[model samples]
Target: MDRLIVMKTFVTVAKSSSFSAAARELAISGSLVSRHVADLERQVGVRLVNRTARSVSLTDAGTRYADFARRILSEIDEEDTALSESRDRPEGTLSVICPKWIGTLDLGDAIAAFVKAHPLITMRFELGGMSDRNYDFLERGYDVAFHTRDLRDSNVLVRRVSELPFVLVAAADYVRRHGAPTTTAELAEHQCILHPNDPVWRLGAGAETSHHKVQHPSVVANSYLVIEKLVEQGAGIALIPRRPAVERLASGDLVEVLPQHQPPARALYAVHGPGGHTPERVRIFLDFMTVWFRSRPAAHAA
Candidate 1:
């Protein structure tokens, strides 16, 4: 089998996690798919797939190789598209991945505008969990990712889109019942809703920084939306991004606590995989999003 065909087969099988499914998608026989994968594994001198009667899973090495294979295939597609399309018109699928809460709010509007402007280009938007790492985007064929955390990956291009302000807030009822904290020390007395990753809240005022480990949380969750909902229902206090909590805060459903001390703002980044050539469509979309975010009231305030 050709190396390219073998690579494609391996990638398909890895993605679908079943040789039969890959074969069906590729219009090839299951045995042929298996043989191609086996040949590729033998040539590479590594076991790519762990096969069982019930299911199949990729080995650690297989997962890494799959990432490489997908990139290679994407590059090939880009090259073919560039050679075929006119320079004036940019067209192709632009897949993006972003945290659920952010995507559900303003990011969705950004994408909608991009699509409206460039009807020739298609898009795939994935709403992922908060803790999802950058590599997961590359592995899943995402051309771009909207991430709030600082990333250390040199393989991707990271561009700052905007700074997001995080504020500690609670339901007005909860604040009235439990009494709003006037100082950092008072935070310990409140039934805080904790972000699992940020167990120790970092409260900042001017040049001063204070870290407090929340002793007891009425609710702890990985999702910002969940935390906001809990806080809105007066279940507990939570730290949330300004955009998601804005409506609640305005409606008095949630009130800012210790307004003088806020959590350090996090920068939102637009990240792309390493390919010497980034698509013109991808570039345009990213640029538009950056400008759109900057013009937004929430980002401007931050």
Candidate 2:
């Protein structure tokens, strides 16, 4: 018996819970399905299913094996689909979700270029706010999600594409008026724009790492863009990523404070749904995003 065919038959039986149903679904004889199950049970040396006149249920070990078998079969299907789609025409709508700041910066441009290159592909980019949940993207029908924070779920596939540098910045006027802090100890004296719960700032010095407790700002905003604007308008000093603050720094609208003690970089990751049964379009989009971000300086620059 072919191993793939046996696995498929097992999965079908497990899902339908009846040999007749499995046989009908696979368009094979019920006796053949029963024989396959018997062969699989013999190979494993255990009874997988308990069948009676009234009901058919999986045994404890059978339940676990069924889960694994389902995942294996799904992966095989996904791999086959990916290989087939690679040779065929690539045409599909690619949906993406990303944090607000990064999307506004270089990521937006890269996506635009991707769309231009693949005229047949349609793209939908959703900007995530502070309250947006990453997993909600799956429910909202997004194909991929870009995130900068650590994920808790082990099921999702996460790939670190690049690192983004963050810096403590303030408008020149604000710094001059408030006086620059020469030491981390003096950071508490100034009005800081806090990112709500993110209070610890990692200041880097050569091989050493130093953490500073930033002084809470007089005002707190959930949006990073709002924080950047507040700092740009000389509201207060804010810890912001390098890319979004680049133009302001060059134009002298915002100045990097204590550049030598800049914080450790944050990782930008491309997260996707589980690959066990992922679609070909989603896999292709994820591959493209990884390659696209890796080659861009804006995602890695300090």
Candidate 3:
């Protein structure tokens, strides 16, 4: 009764020119094969076969229909094979999104390396413009979204990519002018540049951890790069991700404040839609990013 089954039976019968042969080839009963051809003919409103005492042959309409059917079946097979291969092979366009700052630094380098290694995979990497709502990336058609914070969404899936280190930095000029805070309590007296979303800086690790809320913010900006620049200009002390600040720290442009007390590291996460089977492209990319961050743990130290 299924159209594809009937089409297949008719196609086989057309090739063999015998219902018995088609039944034998398809491993069905001869009557079923005859019924399949009859159903197909009735659907098309045309007699598709001519039977003689010794042989069977296709009618004029049957010959044309046979050709179309064969082509359609062939295309269907090709499409099925392609889809199956895509599930196993990493050979498709992978759309990914992340925060603007992370996408521009070490994470960007990892993605670039992945692109070079897997020539079959086409990647679309976007920076910034991430929504506060966690699952928004899935609706926007992104295959993966990177996050610096932990996400607890039932509609989405998450993997721990790496732990990102946060460093409290101030310019050499600022340190000379205000003097560095030797203890956690002294930080209250210093001018701080704060990200509105991250007003409290969690210092230390484990039980020794302490939270310091920004008491006097000289400048408030959402962009970490802008905050880094402001910190370099001696505007105020700020806590920032260490990856982008690596070069500046090495060049002595920025100095760490309260060397004994470092801010707690945050986990970097890769978020995707909830599914038991992750696409090969997205899976491979997530694996690569995890390794990339793991290899650069030194840069993550505050």
In candidate 3, what residue range of length 10 has the lowest lDDT sum?
293-302
TM-score of 1: 0.67
Per-model TM against the reference: 0.67, 0.64, 0.85
- lDDT by residue (tens digit), candidate 1, 245-297: 77777788888887878788878899988777777878888888898887885
TM-score, candidate 3, is: 0.85
Ranked candidates (lDDT, high to low): 3, 1, 2
140-238: candidate 2 lDDT, tens digit per residue = 787788888887776577778777778889999898799788877788888888876467777876776778876566677766778888998888878
Candidate 2 at residue 139, lDDT? 75
Cα deviation at 274, candidate 1, in Å, is 2.7
- Candidate 1, which ten residues in sequence have the lowest lDDT sum? 82-91
Give the candidate number with the greatest lDDT. 3
| Steric overlap count per candidate | 0, 0, 1
Expressed as tens digits, the lDDT of each residue in 107-189 for candidate 3 is 87888889999999989999988999999999999999999888899999999988878899999899989898998888889
Selected candidate, larger lDDT, 2 vs 3: 3
80 in model 3: Cα distance from truth in Å? 2.9
